[model samples]
Target: MEQRSVGDIEGPWIEPEFDSNLIRRCRENWAVSIGQVANGVLATFIRQRVGLSIVVPEAKCRIEARYDDDSEMYDGELAAALADLS
Candidate 1:
């Protein structure tokens, strides 16, 4: 399996597709709820996973969540985690 570092998500969760307008609009909404879900929902998901860890450093606004990309609702959960970071 391929593993991506948590640091990479610190910036933007680049939309898989080529569009940006919808992504930007959706991200705005996600940014608002990140705090509520990231700490609770996202953390739980990461914790349950085998090789994944979600770390929120006090110094930097970076959230690292490593796990199976094929899991259920994986992208949504990850987006929540990334939003929660900062």
Candidate 2:
């Protein structure tokens, strides 16, 4: 899995008027990772089996799985263990 920080993805284009609290919330609550699976079926299986909140983009061979931080992004060990299971 390749992980990226929110700032890396969003860049510096955010409007100046954007709420600081909202930006902080996003930084605190979200994590982004990119990975490729064999196909849609395998991707779906992983999503269901892992039980982590994820979004799998449609693709023939490569897919991006976006994992939502339900554990407040602090449970890396748990996430790693579950990922190994899947």
Tens-digit lDDT track for model 2 on 1-86? 42433334444334455576544444333343333222332333333342133322222113134433343224343334345553
lDDT of 1 by residue, 1-86 (tens): 11233323344444665656544443443333333333333343343331233233311132333433343355555546445544
Q: For each candidate, give its TM-score against the true structure.
A: 0.22, 0.24
Model 1, TM vs. native: 0.22
- Deviating ranges (above 4 Å) for candidate 2: 13-15, 18-21, 28-86
* Candidate 1 segments exceeding 4 Å error: 1-9, 18-34, 38-40, 44-86
How far out, in Å, is residue 4 in model 1? 21
| Leading candidate by TM-score | 2
lDDT of 1 at 64: 37
Per-candidate total of colliding backbone pairs:
0, 0
Evaluated against the true structure, the overall lDDT of model 1 is: 0.37
